[model samples]
Target: MFIEDIRNDFYNILLGNRVLLLVHYDVDAICACKILQGLFKCDNISYTLVPVGGISELKTAYEENNEEIKYVVLINCGGTIDLVDILQPDEEVVFFVLDSHKPTDICNVYSDGQVRLVYKDDEENIPNFDDIFRDEEDDENEESGSGREGLEALVERRRARKEWEERRHTLMFNYTQFSYYGKPSACVLIELSALASRLSQAALWAAAVAAEAHAALYVRSPARCLLDAEALHRYVAAARRHDDSTANRTACVVMEKDAWLPLYREWTLEAALSHAAMLAPKLKLYARSGSSRLRQLLADMGFPLQQARQAYRSMDVELRRSLLTALETAAPKHKLPVPTKATFILQRPHMSPLAALDAVYVIMALIEHETLPKAEGFQLALAALEVSGENEAWRKGSAAARRCLQAVASLVHATLSARKLLLAGPFSYFIVQDGTPEASVVRGPLWLGEAARWAAGGAARPLLASAATDPHTSILLGLPPRFEQEPRNLFGAAFEQAATKSGVTVSLDNVDTSVITLPTSQRAQFLDALTALLA
Candidate 1:
């Protein structure tokens, strides 16, 4: 059943119950899980939180922790698949799912009472229950009745049912043809909690980071992100009432116009402008004249060459304050997009205010860290998101994010220079060879997705990028085209079809349908099949 009133139907229902919270391993899910945990703690509701990476991990976590868990809550997972079919929970056990992935499985959407979904997206055209289901009593009666005329009626009824079934199949195919994010699940939870008068700083910050995650990954549209954050602005106003800037070093959450560069505050401004995905291509940083053009842009903005090269934090205070104005006045002449927008920031006394986008990269690096177990990474990410100072683990994750961005820029430049990106019938693709310099860095789906976008340039088509893990296997990441304003990826369904049609051995273990693992031996055949299907 779909939930319309979250405070009444979802929050109040779990007030006194022991809940099993299974969260997926991702940046947005981590933030959403933290928000829920804070809300649960305040109400004195006992719950066990487990982070699951895929369907198999989800099942194992549910079975091991479901001792007396009658109310189960899943975040960013278990929505695309049938819950009852997979979990087989007891009849009394109710599942509350808050997943951003779409389209939601028909079984869950049409479930009677045991399952409840906490998301509502305006774009999703869910099928009507009558269109997809039929009553069994009528069929039984049609079978049991006896007579010549009755026999003819039964045949007619069966024929009608078959026609309805065929139509239902077509409707389902169209609905689930693409996989995309709806909104940040954390922001949804925060909005509902505020309706119940249960808002907190931690929850607001978490929601902010989750919203930034969507924008950073390009999984959600920029307009949608701003629309969803409208509700969050009210909370920020209330939270920012009395605290002065230097009061005991208390952390303050503020919304203000800042540069769109990812980590310009933490990193040097020059590096950020050159390597950030939003600015790199716009500045034509790959060409030989790119550097001189950048210097000229800065000079025309009245910013000194030395100040532009220095770390943003160490740059003169007056010049730092003038950046947004300078860019607004001069960036357009250089054919660059607007470089400033109002974003959420976590500011502490006598330190740099951390932007939501900056926090997203750090948290994501922790969750997908090469050395840490996913469960441990989840813990580290949660701790890192606190208002307090960063621990050693947090610092390590920040360093990793910098390296990852450098590798992404490196791979994008190498691919463009070598002309390795290939254009096919309906899509474009680039491969990271087995022993390439930055091949290992782009192995993770998130990194590869960033690389694919960078290499896509101005082409209005999906880009598929693969990184070889070994001679036998490679990992694939799919992204929407550059011109797609809403950014719904078609490759999720296309990958499934191509794998089956090509007879390739592939693994679809991740909750993200756009990522897949297949043998290197059959890469060509799989591409041929995918091209045909997409065409």
Candidate 2:
């Protein structure tokens, strides 16, 4: 089908249906949801926003709330996985997917018309039905208005339509055209808003969403950083105009004037809510209303008190304030500052581990704003040590205020002890080849990034590091710039040769720049052999 045909169908489906938005728990997802909310509000359509994490949570949400939902709109997620298989066999739920993740086999089968996917390449390679019907009509009209002039006019019209279609596709945020990691999901919604002829009002919100997504993904994926920079710049400029126009609004007034507001622009209310959703399980905030907490915070920051209370009710303002104060207090102590640099290791033992990662970036932004050198950058890595199950498990326990402190202490201790294996340089590393049980506890990419950042004296550099649980399993983190040429093949051959020489079963498991898992019993010997080869 042609792009126009699909768009027309989308509009038809959305004409009178209630939208149930199942969005992911990230900046991109939040931004996408906000864009949709704006569009839905503009069209006078009723919608509900439900923030979800992965497939399981989405499934649970669907099962519980399938009755009243007319259109299930999935943003940022549900593209990579086969949702058709996941849904009930007799379910009649129609999904409108606005995602950029790589599609699964179920997405390719056009026969399943229930799922209307508005992605980058959904129109590519498919027959343009408009052109086909247009040609047929032109042939019929040739009998009555048959002349060279008429034929020429038809050809010209076709050319114009073709050009418009090409331009429309060009405007889409296609993953294949750039980094292939997927564009911000909000980009797709923004395009839809354009097709719906609401772009003028929706563009600013869309751009802000894109900017937030870019800021959030900057450190996590270098490729995404490069890909999103131009879009972010353009959108931020557009969003500034909107921001300026809304400067007098209560929300804006509170956000801009809040003394406790984090320095980062991306750490806005939407981003915080998204992070809270992800950290809910760990923070024990799931039982409490996150929206209420946000509103209460705004009220405390001088937003209209009555309005804040009306918007967010059924929660104690004092309890919410206490929670916020605890998080603020716990954030600074786990931040291990380097001696002579603006670098810190934000090891979170009490906070939601991954959610605390967002806090680390916010801290980096603060450091950058305050004390970073004129031309220099700052590095903030994170490490989360395993606290006792009773402390880490927030759901089954109480006295979270006390547990938070204990968790931070455990994280700080683990981070300090892990600093012993440091090998500092431009290509810094921390070799965890000590076959001790204590060393095995520190795992994951976050730990690796923290180790590398520490070894480099908090300097931002391409790092090559390795962490081993035992002699048989080791994970290599970060790819140094010098080893970019044929990294996979080079690492593969080197590891093979090292394994052969050391007479141990050594092999590279999914070797890539960010991470490379090596399975071998003689990890120390393997590292020595590879180091000798590189030297």
Candidate 3:
């Protein structure tokens, strides 16, 4: 019913308006954008696609283009954000949120017809429609009863109401639990396309895109499988019928098993190509401006301007294959493992973060497929060497990697030295004194990963490790094989109370895997307090 209501509004708003599509930089968001773009093209609507990373970028993009934009459709984001607070006081731009994230109090703040928030709520926890109607029928049929019977009926009704309230209070989005990948955002787009009579042409593409997003989660942590098997199978079958390719079939199979598979491996070539195809338009835009090495590579690989543009439109399998090959050839070569460890170094000068991450994907795929002996856990050190002065991005990335390595080393040494370490659930707790070399260079996530590996003597669960940065600040990091039920923020009331007792300040930087800042002077006291709380 909620979806149908939003669908009616969405169709109404699309009439005679130019559209601005703001999408997140992920597979799901990209797929949703493609689906909407296809629909817009069919309807002869002019639209612009803008890929944004965070709330700040979304705000900036809106401010710059709000004048020309009549309708803004946000995909995969903007649900949790308070849009009314972010938008200009008098801005009349219409917004349609197709997101699954938790929403803020926007409807109450902005009651105008300009904003429409479409999302899943606590519907699952609510009584079923049949049950509600049945209860109403029973109420109507009930006759005046004895005092005892009436009292019993009142008590039973109150008990049922309490149970419903408890369920409502505990309700959470299913996707957060990795139960299914058919998110409301994607489903809404599918339904919209069906209403327009384009489902036959567009459904498979949308499903494949959602499937790819679902599959991507497995690459990092198989223990936390994100795709529903039945849903994934159905999508994969649809993809096969739409355009059966070796890559498509391989992706479906790999996704089903919840295993680690490289995107560029022979079997997953299609998925890799799809990724390149999605990126081609963005690459082409960059190519038009200045001299880009990637553009040149595409040209050298026999893809001229016309051919490159065509690939963006159609995502031809052969073109995708060619592009994937060229990228692989141009990618930075992996170095030999460190003497006795599974650490490989890769350096490419002036590479963008996207390119660097792509390289990581490629390399990880290779390693996983190769299954090299003596590989306990693999560590990759990537650097974008600067030709000019100093590349700050590369410097920062390299420094973080170095810090991780140093932190791992310190952790291992401490473990061998029998330093006091406490284990609570998936957490391995220890503290570093302020101003120490180790404290200065230690990073939370990296430390947790390496420490967990050593502590477990094999594959490890998600872990949390903390270190004191200074007398008034402590850093916390969580390594993942995460579940939905895990506590988001590490420092809660108990930790705050401990901080207060020790005259420390506590601050959480993020929700998941938070970087907690607290007083360093009471490091031991804080650890003790945390231990007691955790215990």
Best by lDDT: 1
lDDT of 1 by residue, 1-535 (tens): 8998898899899988899999998888999988888888788999998999888888999999988889999999999889999989999999999999888889999899889999878878998999888898877786865799879888999899899999999988889888888878998989977887777777888998998888777787878878877888878887787455334347777888888887887778777777777778777666678789888888878888788788888999998989889878878899888788888998876766788888888887787676777788889888877866556766877887888888888888777777788998888899898787788777777778778877876468788999885678898878877633668877888899999898999888778888898998888889999999888
lDDT of every predicted structure (CA atoms): 0.84, 0.43, 0.44
Off by over 4 Å in 1: 137-155, 242-249, 469-471
**lDDT by residue (tens digit), candidate 2, 1-535:** 1123535766557767887777754445555665666677788887766655456767877777777776788776666555677766245667877664443223433425666676654323333335222345644654454589868877876787677667546532231222122556666566666668675433433343344334333332434444543443444345446667876221110011111211112223322322331222222222346446444444443434443233222234663344344444443343411111111111223432222123333322222222333122111100001112122222211122122222322332343445543443333455654553334333434334333433333233444667674556776655433221211113334455556676666433321224456664565565666666656
lDDT of 3 at 269: 29
Worst lDDT window (10 residues) for model 3?
336-345
Candidate 3's error at 432, in angstroms? 14
Q: Of models 2 and 3, which has the larger TM-score?
A: 3
lDDT pick, better of 2 and 3 = 3
State model 3's lDDT.
0.44
Give per-residue CA lDDT, model 3, range 1-535, as digits (tens): 2333654668656767888878764445544665676678777887776666557778877787776677888886665555667666346777787764332233412435566765454412323443222355645535445599887876787677667656544442221222122253554566566667665324433434343433332212222223322343444346455545443322111122211212222223222222332232223222224236445545555566555544233545676555534544433321211111111111213431122222233222221222222121121111122212234433433334433433544554454356455566535655545555655444333244344333323223444466654455666544333322222223333455555665545553322213355555555566666556556
Best by TM-score: 1
TM-score of 2: 0.41
Q: Per-residue lDDT for 448 in model 3?
A: 40
